[model samples]
Target chain A: MTIEFDAPSRDKLALEEGTSFTPKFDANGLITAVVTDADDNALLMVAHMNAEALMLTLDTGIAHYFSRSRGKIWKKGETSGNLQTVVDVLTDCDQDALLIKVRVAGHDATCHTGRRSCFYRSVRITDGVPRLISIDEHRHFVPSEVYKA
Target chain B: MTIEFDAPSRDKLALEEGTSFTPKFDANGLITAVVTDADDNALLMVAHMNAEALMLTLDTGIAHYFSRSRGKIWKKGETSGNLQTVVDVLTDCDQDALLIKVRVAGHDATCHTGRRSCFYRSVRITDGVPRLISIDEHRHFVPSEVYKA
Candidate 1:
C-alpha cells in the first residue's frame, strides 16, 4: 500500500505539533533527505525523495531516493554495495525536509566516488584565488571496479 | 567582484583532483548547504545558496541564504541575534553541495522555533500509524520574545 500525506492544517495539533506527518513536497513532488551515519554524526549524502520513496524508506528501513536523472526510484547502494539501513528518521518543523540516520553496510561508503562521504574536499581561497583541496583523501573502493563490474 | 565557478572538467585536473573550484548549481541556480555546529558535529540547518548568497557567506564567514519565500538573499540571524560564524566550508566531490561548519552566536539557535537544530522531531510508526514524537524538546529561546521585537 502507498502512503499519502495530508496538507498541514490550522488545527493546533496540526500546526504547533501534529500527530500526523504532513510533508510539503515541492513543485517536483520531492523533498530533501539529509542522510548521516548513525554511529557518528558524519553526513553521508543528500538526496531527494518522492512520497513513494519516503514511504518505502520508512517501511523497508532502507534508504531509497528519487533519481532525477534516471527519473526512477533509486535504492541507495544497490549498485555500490554500500546499502544504508535506516536507524532513525527525523523531520524538521515545517515538514519540508527529512534527516535520516543510518548504518551503512558493506564498504560503509555513501559516495559514488567511493569516498566515505560525498563531501571530501574543502574550498580554499589562498592568494585571492579560489581552489579545492582534498581533505579526507580516503577511498573505500575504486569506483571503476564497483560501477563497471 | 562576484565569483563564478567553472563547469567541472573531465580533465585529470577536475576528475582525478583539481585545484579549481567548479560548483554545479541546479536549474534553480542554487546549491544545497548543509550546516553543522563547529563546536560539535550537531547538524544545525540545511539551507540553499545562490551565487550571491554563497559568495557572501564565503566572504563574510557568516551564514547567508537565498530565501525562497521572500525572494531575497538572507543573512541568517539578521533579524534574530543568532548569527553563524563559519569555521570551515567543505565541498562534495561533485562540488554541488557544501558542508558548512559554523560557530553559532547569540543563543546558538539555528531554528526559528528556538531549537539549536531545526530537526527536533522523530517520526515513528506505532499501532501501524505514523506519528511524530518530539526528540529534542529543548527550546533555547521563546520565539515570541525573539521575533516580536
Candidate 2:
C-alpha cells in the first residue's frame, strides 16, 4: 500500500491546526529530517527524505533518507548495522521539516565516524575565526572495522 | 571586519577531525540550522543561514537567519520582541548543518505562532494513513498583538 500526502493547504490556520500530515518538500523533492536519540533527546543527525523515504519510514518504523550524493534512497545504516527505529515523528509549525525521535540499533551510533551523535563538535571563535572542538570523544565502534566490507 | 570560510576539505579525516570550520554550503549558499531551547533542549525550529547570516549570528551572539521567501537576512523575532540569544553552536559530522542552543526573550517563543516551540504536532499512522496530532497547546502570546507592526 502506498501512502500519499495531500498537497499542503495554502491556509495557514489549517496547516498549523489541522490533523492532516502534508509535508512541504523543497524543489529537490526532499524534506529535511532532524534526528534525535529517544532516550536522551540528543541530536543524532540531520538528513533529507524524499517522498519514498518518508513513506518507507512511516510504513516500516525505520529511518530512511535520500542521499543527495548518491542520488538515491538510502536506508540509513543498512551496511553499518545502525538502523534507527522510529519512536516519534513530529512536524514543525510550517510542516516543512521533521523531528524524528528514534532508538538506534546495532552499535547505537548515528554518525559515520562511529560517534553516537553527528553533533560531536562545538564551534567556538578564537580570535574571530571559528574553530571546531571535539566535545564527545566516546566512539561506540571502530568505523574501519564496521564498514570494512 | 569580514569573515570568510575556506572551501571544504575533500579528505574525510581532515574534514571531520580538523579544527578549522569549513562549512559545506549548498548550491544556494545556504546551510541548514536546527534550533533548540537552551534549558530543556526542546526542538524549537529549523531554518537556513547564508554565510553573512551565519557570521552575523556568531559575531553578535544573536540568532540570525536567511529568509528564503523574503530574500533577505532575518533577525529572528526582531518584530515580535522574542530575540534568541545564542547559548551554543554545534556542527554535525559533515559541517553542512548547525545545531544552535538559544534562550528566547519576551514570551520565550521561537515560532511565529507564539508557541514556545515549532514542534507542537506529532505525526502518527492511523489506519495506514498518517495524521498529525497536536501534542502541545500552550500559546505564550497572541500572534495578532505580537506581530501587529
Candidate 3:
C-alpha cells in the first residue's frame, strides 16, 4: 500500500508533538529532500520528491526523486548505475522537509557530472569578484563515459 | 543590491560548462536552501530564500531566509539571538538549489524547538506502523524559556 500523510495540524504543540507524518508539500505537490552521505555526513544532493517518490523510497529502500525538469518520477542512478541505498530517513519537527541518509553504490558518485557530491565548488568573493572554486575536484566517473549508451 | 540570475539555458553543455550564477527559481521566485554545519558537515536546516534573502546573506555574511508563512525577509535569529554566520555558499550544477555552510551563534541552536537543528526525529516503520523516534534528543536550550523573552 502506498504511504499516506495525516492532515497537518496547525496547533504548535500538536504539530511538533504529534505522531503523524504530515509533510507540508508546496503548492506544486512537492517536498524538499536533503540527502547526505551516511559515512561522512557530507551534503550530497538536494532534490524534490512527490508522494509517489517518497512512498517508493520508503517501500523499496532506494532513493526515488521527482525530477521537475524531466516531469517524471526519477529512480536515482537508474541510468548512471550509481544507485543510492537509503540508510535512514528523518523528518523535521514540522514535517515539511526530510533528511535522508544514504549509502551511494556504484562509483560512489551522486552528481551527473561524476562528482562525489553535487556541491563540488565553493563560492567565493575574491578580488571583489564572485567566482566558483573547485573544491572536491575528484570525479568518481567520467560523465561522457557513464551517460553514453 | 539584490542578486539577479543569469538566464537559464537548456543546453546541457552550456549549462554545465558555463561559469555564471544562473539559478532557475520557481514561479514563486524562491530557491531551496539547504544548510549544513560548517564545522561538522551535519545537515542543519532547509529553508527557502528569495533573491533578496540570498543577496543579503551574501552581502552581510549572515544567514537570511524568506519566511513563507510570515511572508517577509527573516533575518535569522533576529528574535532568538541565534544568528548564523555564513561560512560558504555553494550552488549546484544547474543552480536551482543552494548549499549554505554556516557557523551558528548564540546557543548553537538552529531550531525553534530548542534543538541544534530543525531535524530532531527519525521516521521509521515498525510492526506495520510508522512512528517517530527522537534522534538528536539533546536540547541545547529550552524553547519556552528562550522564546518567552
Q: What C-alpha lDDT, on a 0 to 100 scale, does residue B104 get in candidate 3?
A: 92
Q: Which ten residues in a row have the lowest lDDT in candidate 2 chain A?
A: A122-131
Top lDDT prediction, candidate number: 2
- Which runs of model 3 end up more than 4 angstroms from their true locations? A126-129, B1-4
Q: A55-142, model 1: which lDDT tens digit per residue?
A: 9998899999999879999999998889999999888877888899999998988988888998888888766556888887788999
lDDT of 2 at A30: 98
Error of 2 at B71 (Å): 0.8
- Runs with alpha carbons beyond 4 Å of true place in candidate 1: A10-16, B8-16
What is the lDDT, from 0 to 100, of the residue B2 in candidate 3? 43
Error of 2 at B55 (Å): 0.4
- Give the alpha carbon lDDT tens digit for every residue of A38-135 in model 3: 98999889998988898898888999999988999999999888999999998887888999899999999999999988887767765444566777
Candidate 2: share of reference interface contacts reproduced: 0.80
Better structure of 1 and 2 per TM-score: 2
DockQ of candidates 1 onward, in order? 0.65, 0.79, 0.58
Pairs with steric clashes in candidate 2: none
* lDDT, model 3, position B35: 90
User: On residues A28-62, what C-alpha lDDT tens digit does candidate 2 reach at each position?
Assistant: 99999999988888889999999999999999999
- Give the higher-TM-score candidate: 2 or 3: 2
Candidate scoring better on TM-score of 1 and 3? 3
